[model samples]
Target: MKYKNPVISGFHPDPSICKVGENFFLVTSSFEYFPGIPIFQSKNLVNWEQIGHVLTREAQLPLKREHSFIPSQGIFAPTIRYHKGRFYVITTNITIRKTFYVWAEHPEGPWSDPIFIDGFRGYDPSLFFDDNDKVYITGASFPGAGPEGIFQAELDIDSGKMISESQFVWEGTGGSSPEGPHLYKINDWYYLLVAEGGTEYGHMVTIARSRKPYGPFESNPHNPILSNRSTKLPIQATGHADLIQASDGTWWAVFLGFRPVKSTKVHHLGRETNLAAVEWSEEGWPVIGENGRAKVEHDAKLLLVNEPTPWLERDDFNCESLATVWNFYRNPLESSWSLTEQQGFLTLYGQSCTLNDLESPTFVGRRQQHFNCEVSTLMEFSPTEEGEEAGLTVFMNENYHYDIAKMIQKGQTIILFRCRVGSLWKVVKEILYDEPSVVLKIKATDTSFTFSYATPTGEEKVIGSGETSLLSTQIAGGFTGLYFGLYATGNGKCSTAPAHFDYFQYVPGQE
Candidate 1:
């Protein structure tokens, strides 16, 4: 059985995992998406289902709806661990400059509110439970003094506080940015695994070992024991890894990597989740795959379920609340949208922020997981003011997104197509319409996004097409992937009008 790469797809990145009983649980970085820190459960490492989010309520998260977020801010990296019958997740919020942890009796749960670790600094936090039951926390950071390396301190899990002075453990294999530290006491040797080099082509996993928890450690002779940095494998930036041993005594590593668009080096889908098999060398070193490079296919015997879900592209909106797949840009103000009020439709009340504003602008979206795909939605909207409008968006971030909306231009209702990249903002296409409702569509082929609108008669025509490469991380300069979202805004002033979305559908394809 050959397990395919990207056991998890789309923008899910910075994966961390832990095992309990016969099950494995994982968590990933959310980075500005509300209901942050997606938690997943898997009986086998290959197939997973999102059980819930760690930060559900705003009181614990506090990413204000009206606030603007820069790229790669908000939630950074999360590490999950199960100890003494409790599940713990530790991570950082860059925008708030804080580190916190949440724990539950079970992997899926009504998790306890965040316990902020006072004076905890840096990012990519992890937890390690020693055999003696002494708990420790480590993170990537450069403090004011001492050599820069992974830092660690004894932690009081119950109080969410650091109990001991921090110390620098390992500097990694001298990679550009050594981060994502996970420590394990395996066979009496403390093994320290850290991802280094930047997160692109040079990303790699390096290891070190110390007899004591605090190390003047020895770097693995085969230093970067795992990486695809020098390979032609479809998975690139292979690092940021966590290890878990199964009840059967098998070892596996879960890491983050990206699947670039076919033949192109650019990837807009963002870093995704990948897995690899690990083996111990006679010298006690952990070797990844047969040749020390992450493999695209692993032995079928390792995974109980090797099937990955085909892209889920359609949502009916008839449910009482938004499904787990849909995510908001920031903390969504609960009063601005609803599903029960209209029944079978999502009504988004127009807010003051435009699509270009970092503040929440009555928008909700899902990841664009495929290069060749089509996303469309039926929207019923009536714009009474010039700046008031609502429709669909291909969003990368505040400054880099494409908007195809319905707006009022000089008292006439029309379909509008606008392009925004950095400081460039211009309406690329417009079409006048006599009707107040229309179905808007965006067909994303390998190279471009083709915008279209359909009439009541069910006929459709292309309104405009734009280069898809414009949304790539190389051009957009963000740590997030693309999201297809429904949006309504008044530019700056709030509008009373609402945009009713009949449904949103995404059809995956290839060319």
Candidate 2:
């Protein structure tokens, strides 16, 4: 089955893909979002499944304080490749302003700690290994060098290190601003593919070919092989591509595009992943899409064999380790979160005194996919002092978030819904309940959200409701999806009470 619009939709952007035998794997740059790069697998180019994130452990990629809260600025344009019995991925942390690489024997891995490359050289770095066992690293231009262009250098695969100094190979045709450069060898020619015209309205996939790995490559006559018809269409920003050939010799390319809701230009869902077919032309250039433009929909006949189970939505909490679906807001202290016994309850220990601070240590989260849904969790409390709160929240960045939480005030539980915009947090609703345990439920429809609570007798009452517009990336301005989660922290000690999450579910429909 082919997904017409989004094969892997909604903020799953800057797709880099590769095929090993009959199997295919795709990865996306996760920016500052922890559990860095998400690894997706697809048998056919159309359907994709989230295998896991490449950086589960902090050792894989070291994230600092400044880059942690802002998810968009940390990681950009990750390129994944499988070679010589190992999977290698090279990416740039624009915040840290450096490039690093990691490898694993398997795709869903215990990947090695990052091997930081030597120079503070490039951005959007990609790897290409030649047929004669020569390894090369190619990337887009950096600040000090020439104008926006593509550069290539030799590399040592084993050490994840660069061999010789890089040289400028292609300057792009006159006015074209080429970025996201990836190299491939085909039919005795090294083809350099790049995304030009910036990452905005005029974005496109252009190609230049050379007979040698490092040489004077010539641009294709039909410059843009794949692009949206820029003639007044709302959807724009359609480039930054990576290509792969299947076991059956079928070629495909994955790139990024943005479809705005109200406006024709800006993308609130961030850059979306798009797929297109490529064919080698008789004249030796690649012909992309069907008529040389990205097909707005997918071809059903080109679909492949297997289907993918995207991600694990439900957790029984009956395991010692946490599920891969959970990611910390910042790099986490592994000791801070754990499952109590082999039961269906997950416990988050308190670290930060308040949820409003960037240095807070509390881990609060839920996955970023799915549209309309409901999430509920129960917390048992034995608070000795005031200011200990535990509750549910919808978070975008540290600057924008809204939550409904219950805190202990002189042995009483106070439920309050608070929203944070910029640095201001205002209480929207408040209720005082004399209950030790209460169930908190948040129902999210297509446009708005409502919160309700129960007395454990299944008798529930509505507490607060508002526009879920806070979940938009436009207001928050980050390269990540909105997350809802359970949290606990602040000025008191919690003992003898287990935080229980009965179940979390998502049912599609407008209610």
Candidate 3:
């Protein structure tokens, strides 16, 4: 049996997994995107479903990143654990500089309000439950130590506060950025797994062990048991992993990795979740997928559990609320969008903001998982003001985005293609239109994206095409990937009406 490298695809990065009964639950980092920390559930490692988001409300994740953190600067990384009867998610809000913990009785939950882990500072927090029922939190930071390093502390789960002084535990395999630490007691020794070498080209997974939960940790002889930096593997930057024991007692790991565009170093879809098989050596060390290079396909069981389905690719705007897959850039204005107000349509009220502004503009998007795909939406928008515009976008961040909008010009509304890279903003193409309602579409490949709109006679004509590589992290310089969805804005002036989206669809191309 063979399974693909990225068992979970797209911008769902920084994966952390824990088992509960016969099910495996996982979570990933969601920087600056509201409804943060997506949660997934699986019966077998090969198939996963987005069960829900941990932070579902703006109050839970109040990202004031406009003046400080940008699109990819808010949430750092998260670690999930199952202990007692509750499931815990520990994460750091880089924008606010606070490490917090949230828990729920069920994986899909009304999770508890965050309790700041006071006195504990820094990022990539993880929880460890020892055999004695004691819990520990590990993070990449100094604990009043001689230098910045991975630290550990006993935690009171109920208060979400440290009960013991934090101590510097493992110094890593000397890889840069020693972070995303998780602790587990395998046999008689407790194992510490941490990702180092940063989160890019040199990213890797290293392990250390100690007799106790906190100290005398020795780095594994074969440190960095997983990584692709030294290989020609297409799955680059494979690290930040979490381990789980399946029902059959097979050990597996779930981590984040990116698949670059063919013949190019550019990967715009961002770091995605990849699954791998783990084998424990006789010396009590875990050896990862074939010399730390995972194959594109794998299967742990000769008997597969459930057949998998492609990620969500379409929405008819017929639901009561937004689907679990949709996300806003940051804190969207509370009253700006609705699904039920127009019945069978998603109405996005034009906000007084543009895509370039750090402020939250009216936008709702999904991750661009595949490079070659077709995304289209039927939008009925009548912009009454010059600055008001509504359409689709292949967005990276505020500074780097491309928009195909039906905007008000002079007094008439016209379909236009707006491209912005850093400080440059230009209208690449436009077509005069008497109708406000039009079907906007974007056909994208590894190299470029073609923006088009449907004519009155139902003919879809290309309005503009731009280099897709520009949105890559290598070019845009962000920790995020491509997000294609609907956008409506007024450029600081509010609109008189809302933009109505009847349906949205994305059809992935063949591999």
Local distance difference test values of all predictions, in order:
0.85, 0.73, 0.86
**Compared to the true structure, candidate 1 yields what TM-score?**
0.96
Ranking by TM-score: 3, 1, 2
Model 2, range 349-392, lDDT digits (tens) per residue?
A: 55544455554346657554444677777655444456676778
Candidate 2: residue 410 lDDT (0-100): 73
* TM-scores, each model vs. reference: 0.96, 0.87, 0.97
**Which candidate number has the best lDDT?**
3
| Candidate 3, pairs of clashing residues | 2-298, 3-297, 3-298
Per-residue lDDT tens digits of candidate 1, residues 351-398? 888777767778999988777899999998888887788989999988
Q: 1 or 3: which has the higher lDDT?
A: 3
**lDDT tens string, model 3, 111-219?**
9898899988768999998888899999988344345668889999888879999888888978888888999998889999999998898999999999988779999
True-vs-predicted CA distance for residue 232, candidate 1, Å: 2.4
Would you list the clashing residue pairs of candidate 1?
Answer: 1-300
